[model samples]
Target: MLAEVQADELVSVDDLIPDQAAEFVSQLSTVEPLPPDDDEMIEDETSENLVEDDSDRSRPVRENGSIYFGECRLLNWTTTAKGGMKADLAILDCPADAVHPFKGLLCGKQNGQRLRVWFGELADTDVPMQVNYQGEALLLRWSDDSVNGMNTQVMLDDGPDGVKGTHPFTGLPIGRVEGHRMKMAVWAINDDESVIDPRKVKRKVPFYQKPETTQAHLLSRRPRFISYVKRHERRLTRGQEIRADITIAPDEYIAEALYAILGITSRSELGDENAVGREARRRWSSLVGEYFDDFYGRR
Candidate 1:
């Protein structure tokens, strides 16, 4: 009956008699709260619209599978340079007799006096990406999300041989169009933009040379990714290196982290058999190993 007390009864506390208090309380009745009619019916006083969905803004805009390719001159040659350029896009040599991932990606699009191709996967063909390579710097116009806003190439100087550029790999001369942005990934492609899995070809190395028991060709499966994440967290906990900033979280942000670290837009990319896909898988594996390895080693 105490639950039946209303604000008015509470206010009458000073006037209430101790002898009749129980009788007064027992005689009163409590009213139950009404359920909400509709979420939309509620009036919001704030100026901002808090109930809107805006996922599209955070996603990258791109034409899936479409890629632009360009050739770069082999101005300087160094294994170290090649390694450094691995993460970025560069015009690699793929002679007519051979199938080069870099050249194959272009799908024989446009060929002209383009010394540099400031391109990315679907890097805005509507407004062709233009690159200006002067003796001092490299400039681009009408850029896309693929290309970073600011980049400058300053290593080369015109030698007595008039701007002798070293090929990043062979240090020899090589191209009509040069790939600039490092974010662009070139997959082996055919006349169309469709990806070609070189491993699937049976003429060379038989597909079933040696297969695993329950072959998991894809490392990006959600379950596998989750396992890696849980393992990583455990390793971090054991090492006493969990972040205090709450920046890296598992489950909820697992997809976000995977995409960010792998530099891919889709999970399917993680399963692809191309250079980019392979590299992503390699990085993911390395990260998991590092987490456990470092934790155990410290002990």
Candidate 2:
């Protein structure tokens, strides 16, 4: 179940995002994150921290009169990923009214360095461009380089699971998309079979409810949180560990920070379904209990 948030507690829907993000996202209608500053750049492992002030990364960006659901903490931004793989954590917040946009950030380890990305700039991975709207049965395409791309072309109506509506490749509805906010489960695909396989390590992502909130509120909000678990594993070993991260929309710093803690801790405690599930539930319960009195005492 989800906790109830008072409207008073939320920034007026209009002010959900700050001015900078608003202006930046607006330009996505025709622009894209200038390619990687340098091809030799590498991802930073320590750049994972949330924006403490309502500065650049924390402010929300507006689009189509709705809050843009893209923002995150910079996790890594290296001149070169080198032989090892780089992981990132980001939180997306596509409101019911806003176009569900996909974006991410790469960070530099010093804790302050980072790079931002709009879904349009992520074409490298072939992130699904067009998804059949579940309710409308319309295929939306990424037309230009802007946030929603450019033009939204409805290719086809809703159909089978893989073809349209909601499916894996089309990460739309892939995360928790409900009410005023949504959350995403992020992963970094690596070359190592052991790392990518669910049997070795699996993780879920978490998100904040409103545009602006404290770390306590960020930690307390559970509905938008992603829960991860290892589906297959035995005799967990430290060397086989994997890196998993988290992200929050409207800010890159926070996502990186959440990723480091959750990733390192969760990876160290890898376990089978029963054990992992139990731990996840416990962590969730404890978190929810601390903030929501209504959720704490109940099953």
Taking all chains together, each candidate's TM-score versus the true structure is 0.19, 0.17
lDDT of 2 by residue, 197-248 (tens): 1111111112332121232234423333322112111112223442333343
lDDT of each: 0.31, 0.27
Tell me how far the alpha carbon of residue 284 in candidate 2 is from the true structure, in angstroms, after superposition: 4.1
Best by lDDT: 1
Model 2 spans with C-alpha error above 4 angstroms? 1-99, 102-267, 288-299
Error in Å for residue 229 of model 2: 23
Task: Please report, as a residue range, the 10-residue window in candidate 2 with the lowest summed lDDT.
Answer: 193-202
